[model samples]
Target chain A: MAGKTPAGSARSDAVRNRRLLLDAAAEAFAEGGVEVSIGEIAQRAGVGKGTVFRHFVSKDELLAAIMLGMLDELIDTASGLTTADDPGAALKGFLTAGVQIFVRDRAFCEVIGRPSLQHAEVRAAIDRLCDVAEQLTARARDRGLVRPGITGTDVALLMAGVQQTAAPLLAAEPQAWRRYLDLVFDGITASTGRELPYPPPSHLSLA
Target chain B: MAGKTPAGSARSDAVRNRRLLLDAAAEAFAEGGVEVSIGEIAQRAGVGKGTVFRHFVSKDELLAAIMLGMLDELIDTASGLTTADDPGAALKGFLTAGVQIFVRDRAFCEVIGRPSLQHAEVRAAIDRLCDVAEQLTARARDRGLVRPGITGTDVALLMAGVQQTAAPLLAAEPQAWRRYLDLVFDGITASTGRELPYPPPSHLSLA
Candidate 1:
């Protein structure tokens, strides 16, 4: 049991180290964007750079991991809203949660166009996010809450658009995104019976 | 006249070279964003690298010049729309022209957050653009064509937002931004009388 105790303790230490690294990396990147270095992240986590390298190979790898976690959280948020009683409110809730992530994490917004977005796992997670968004959008469509011809991809694109548009003003007006989100929501939910000038993109291609 | 001819020829030649450089730089940057090098732009312009440096001190200066041109064009377009017969359609036309510039010029979209945006002349041009946009919005609001509380700054941001949202898919669908523009236009025009959740950003600060 003495030998087994040493092994178990090492495993727990590794698990704790990884968790700390992720949290510290997230905070550092959120504040400084993708340019935050691994050394800085390690220092912030109170660990050595070796610990960070052991957990993640490169900065891109670390960013992809962080993005994957964010995607999972958003996916879960969207999933929960799937059973919401009011479809419009549910869709709005999902967008609110999604944009809030963008607002809080500058790295997430900055990384959208970076090469790390091409990472296989990150791409798959984005695909899953789109699918869940589709479910919510479809629910709203069926209830006639959103206008005709609006697709999940449109909603997904608009969600990011709101973030990009508000990004320049985020420092000055942190809640500015809410106004754009409301504007977009009103746009999508508009019942004026107007048709979008173009069809939705056939698929989600973040890269 | 013969003595002045050589000096005049050199002056004319310089003007022609500057025009060629600007046109070539615009095309190159539009194709490759701000990363397109001055040497490449010179090559595209059929000139020496020295020619680019002589005309513009740095890439940021060149980009600011290009942005100044675009802002001037947009300001002119908005100015024309202010007195149009249909205020709503006029505002839509302004958005269409504005988003089209973003769709065609990738550098324009990419440079929105770069240091070039901080250039004094470019910042003043942007201010003038916001003022003209406000005029258009006010014209529409007075006629009750657009909802209350919509500002020119709001329109300006949403125009950029549509372009950002459609950027990833532009390679596959170049006209995709029209749909987003339509959606946003509908949102601003929705007569459903929903008030925005936040006030208009008090001022525009693109940096």
Candidate 2:
């Protein structure tokens, strides 16, 4: 029993330290981008450099983990909205939550085209996110709210587009993304009977 | 007469070399981004390293020159479109030309937020571009083609948004941007009578 107590305490400490590193790293990266050094992240975590290495094998691994966390949160948000009473509003709610993540986390946006996306876990999570987006979009389409031929992939791409469009002014006008989002939302939902010029992207693969 | 001929020949050679350097540098930066070395640009231009240094003191200067050229071309395109038969088509034409440049030049997009934008010439050129965009947009607004309060800056930002949204898939789907452009164009022109969520940005200063 005495031996087990020490082992259990050590395991809990590892878990706590891991959480601290992730939170600190996320904040540092969000503020400074992925270029924020692991050393800086350790200092921010109030832990030794060796501790960061123990948890994340490399900077890319740490980034992949962070991206996974973000994707999962988005997935959960989309999943929750799938059965909401208003299909259009549900999709908008999901997009608002997703773009909010990009708005707050500069590193997440910077890392989208980086090699970390090639990580298997990150790829799987993105695929899952697309799945949920499709479900939400389909719900709206069925209600005749979204335009015909609009796909979840199109919605997903447009969400990222909204962030990109508002990125330049995010510092000066943090709520600027809302404007672009509304424009894109109106674009998808206006039911003008005009077809999108291109076929929907069949899949979501940023890697 | 003999001395004048020699000097005239030297001046013409310099002019030709400058043109060559600009073309080579533009192509290199478009393909490899701003990280392409001056030596590589000189090599592509078939000029010596000293020739590149003589024409442009630094890489940023070289990049500024390329950007100015691009901006001037866009300005010309926009200027010519102000009197086009259709106001909406003119704005869309301007956006199409602008986005096509972004699609072709990776460095132009990369340098938008970089220090080079702080260069006085680049800043002036961007302001000029915004002015022309304003002219086209105001024409559309007066004709009730564009939604109320949709400023040229809004149109400008959305053009960039379309590029950013399609950037990730550009390699596999070169024309994907056209689809996003159509979506955004539809957004600005739909006239569904919905007010944009936020006021338009007043000016363009990527610096």
Winner by DockQ: 1
Where in model 2 is the C-alpha error above 4 Å? Answer: A1-16, A47-51, A113-117, A204-207, B1-17, B37-52, B113-117, B204-207
* Pairs with backbone N, CA or C atoms under 3 Å apart (clashes), candidate 2: none
Worst 10 residues of 2 chain B by lDDT: B1-10
Candidate 2 docking classification: acceptable
Q: Give lDDT tens digits, candidate 2, residues A101-205.
A: 888887877665433345778777777887899999999999899888888877877776788787767667778899999988888887677787787776754
* Best candidate (score: lDDT): 1
Model 2 Cα lDDT, one tens digit per residue, B37-105: 999999999999999877777778888888888889999999999999999899999999999998889
Could you tell me which 10 consecutive residues in candidate 1 chain B have the lowest summed lDDT? B1-10
Residues A96-139 of candidate 1: C-alpha lDDT, one tens digit per residue: 99889877887877665443345678778777888999999999
Off by over 4 Å in 1: A1-17, A35-52, A113-117, A204-207, B1-13, B46-50, B113-117, B204-207
